[model samples]
Target: MVYRGPYRVRVEEKPDPRIEHPNDAVVRVARAAICGSDLHLYHGMMPDTRVGHTFGHEFIGVVEEVGSSVQNLQVGDKVMVPFNIFCGSCFFCARGLFSNCHNVNPNATAVGAIYGYSHTTGGYDGGQAEMVRVPFADVGPSVIPDWLDDEDALLMTDALATAYFGAQLAEIREGDTVAVLGAGPIGLYAARSAWLMGAGRVVVIDQLPERLEKARTFAHAETINYNEVPDVVLEMKLQTDGLGFDAVIDAVGAEADGNLVQHLTSARFKLQGGSPIALNWAIDGARKGGVISVMGAYGPMFSAVKFGDALNKGLTLRMNQCPVKRQWPRLLEHIQNGYFKPSDIVTHRIPLEHIAEAYHLFSSKLDGCIKPVIIPDAS
Candidate 1:
């Protein structure tokens, strides 16, 4: 099946994918996920999607075949696919930055290209199909532990890595105060990561009560209902003893731009400057010398930033796609060592045939959707 355009899915009979390069391997996709990022691709919002591009990144599968040159992976191995495909020995990958690998996408300067995305990402097919062709197999796939279930390992590829990246960007430490700006799947994982990173308190902000409640129960984070509370920032300050959090992560991105920025900027700048409000809010939210890590996907465009304020306050801002290779080892350790349960973030599970229904439910916030993992072949 291929997506011709927004809201369109067509099943097409095609030759089974096989290893085209020595580094390539073929995998039978056992479990695949529909990431929030996939929503953009589904809605035709991605800039360069075409008719035949397969759509999906988060997937776990069994290695059905391996290329002759493949060294580590073997047939019958169960693996998790990294979102970004990269060569492990590339200049960037050597530095634990697989997201910017030089060899994965020779045509692009990015470290690596993602599967099932636009030409900007190498135009490689995705794992939404029954079988997927994995390029740079040694670098793209990670062997799953024999004891771990597929659902538990699914997030190790994307969301878990992203949440870990958020925590790393925050530079969190023991007793540090951290606040996550959303309670969605990513936000919940961010909260969990913050907790694992030894934050004394993890505060989650969102308008959804069910999500907030889940965060409070599973991630052990304090929850704030943005709607019920008249002033979210004030509530945060009150909880943190009038000093703002040491780290604030904007997981909500542009969707909750209005309130996200308000909570971020209301504490510092009293002047009503009409500058691009999102930037202002981000700047305002950070306490002096605080860290702001933005993991949300933003379009390729420029927004006004308060560089002067950031400089004066000594704030550190970091943003980018998650580097899976860098964080995979640690995340796997966390999962295997009994310190984290990333799978608990999944609130819904549906078969691939019901993908459209899943999309509707997730997009409409119905059925308590909070990261539904799509089982492509589940009967």
Candidate 2:
């Protein structure tokens, strides 16, 4: 898949990736997922999202080749590649902060390298195609367990791991009330993971009816349609006896909708990196000294946020790009115990040829599409 411009992408022939470094490996993609973060690149939200870039960060594949120094993987190994590309020997990676590895991207202070995002993320071509070149092969890609489903393995690359990490950041104590903003895949997974973290109640907030219903059935959380309430934050506070939730998760990022001024300024005019509607709601909807976990994707630009309110409430704010590989062990156990099924949110499986159509459907929220998986060789 090649990006033509915003709202325009097409399947194009590209050269198969080759080993470019001693730590590199080439993988034949079996399944790749269009992440909600990918939508930011699709809408031209991320800086330097140049034309011809392939935008997919969640993928699973079979190792086709490996570099001379590669030790952990060999040909024919089924692997789930983490979205993060890190050298594993960096100062940050040494401490398990793989997302902040300084050895991968030149702009490592902002974020470590990522596959198929854009120049801002190290300019690595993503795995949305038939093949992808993976760097730091021994450090990043994990062999998929035999019992795991292919679709499930694909989501583990990003969504499932990120959501679980968000819950961990929230520091949810036993019986804590948690509120998740947005009913997207990340929010749904955050809600589900909150239960595993011992959250007594989980509430999901969104405007769409179908997504709200999904919060009920899929995440098994209480649902609040922001459209139905006069004030969403007040509604959230009311639900918690006017004390607000113990922990709040913001899963809606730059493209969030709620305030017209915020939408026009950030998402439309590009004056800010992203709209802070969901984030502001999180601040106002959390109790004093409550924790706020941000799992949403935002750009480097400034966003208008309620910093004073957050300070006044003494909210503990924790946010970061997920270190995907770090969360796999715990998530694997959850999957093995049947506590989570990453594929449950997969509502559409589209071939690479129809990716443009798939993007349209997802961007438009058509057909109740929750998540769309790409089949590069569906033909």
Predicted structure with the largest lDDT when compared to the true one: 2
For model 2, residues 48-161, the per-residue Cα lDDT tens digits are 999999888999999999999999999999999999999999899998999988988985477899999899889999988999999989999999999999999999899989
Pick the TM-score winner. 2
Off by over 4 Å in 2: 256-264, 267-273, 300-303
Candidate 1: which pairs clash?
100-111, 101-111, 264-284, 264-285, 265-284, 265-285
> Can you write out model 1's per-residue Cα lDDT over 1-379, one digit (the tens) per residue?
5787776665566689988999899999888887776765665555677887887888889999998899989999999988988888867888878788787775578436888876677788887778899998887788988878788788878887897899889899899999888788888889988987889988888778889999998888988786776666677677777767889887755342222234234332321112233344455566788988887654332345678987988889887788876787777778779888778878888887776677667766787888888776886
- TM-score for each of the candidates: 0.88, 0.96
Which regions of candidate 1 are displaced past 4 Å? 9-14, 231-235, 254-280, 301-303
* Model 2 residue 225 CA deviation in Å: 0.3
Q: Give the TM-score of candidate 1.
A: 0.88
Which clashing pairs does model 2 show?
A: none
